[model samples]
Target: MIEYVARSGPPEAMNCPAFICDACRQQVVGAGIVTWATTIGDGRSRTHSQSPLYVAHKGECGRKVEAMLHAGYPASDGWIDLWDDIGDFLKQLTHNATNAFTDDADGEYHQHRLEGASTNGRMQ
Candidate 1:
């Protein structure tokens, strides 16, 4: 299974860093966040695979990742599949990020989850 984690600070040199913001498509300079994916095997003799790190600006752009997760893009696991439309995906991420706080404040997010769970415990 692959899991992604975000950490404070720029990516280390050993990770073959690229200073590009995955969400905003901007060059990342100081005080950035690094997002990387790790794949671990399920068996006793587990193997691990690390993907190249994704860097993003610490503010709005970085928050898109959190928002995308809240919106449940990759419902199961692994990296987010952008499919063929990267532009559309970015737009969705931005929209979700922009509405994240407002949705939470209005309790709409929780209500939506409750409705979904009551209807079916699976992604429709």
Candidate 2:
């Protein structure tokens, strides 16, 4: 499944060396959004596969991603079931961004940490 996450930090400290916004095709220097996927196994056990990260700017670019997804844009490999709970995802994204903050001192950007909601309706 596809998921959205809000993160903030120095660009160099992110999981990727550089986050290229999938929507605007620009480098994300600070607070930005990330989309990835998680795979679960049967009840006996569970596993996860890391899908290609889809990063985007937190506000407008983030909205663009939502629009593309709604219009049936092709998702990354292993993200075949993106429509499962998109409405909820959009809510989470909007809430997170709306509540996020910025850091101007020393060029560090800080955004509020908002966890994604799991399929079970709990924060993940």
> How well is each residue in 4-105 modelled by candidate 2, as lDDT tens digits?
344568663334345567687777665676654434333244333333435667789877765554334234432332222334455776876866545334
lDDT of 1: 0.45
Clashing pairs in 1: none
Global lDDT of each model? 0.45, 0.48
1-124: candidate 1 lDDT, tens digit per residue: 0123344555543333345666776656556666544444443454443333345576787677445433543435543422212344356667887776565665532111111122322222
TM-score of each: 0.35, 0.35
Each candidate's root-mean-square deviation in Å? 16.3, 15.0
Clashes of 2: 0
In model 2, the worst 10-residue window by lDDT is 77-86
Residue 86 shift from truth in candidate 2, angstroms: 21
For candidate 2, give the lDDT: 0.48
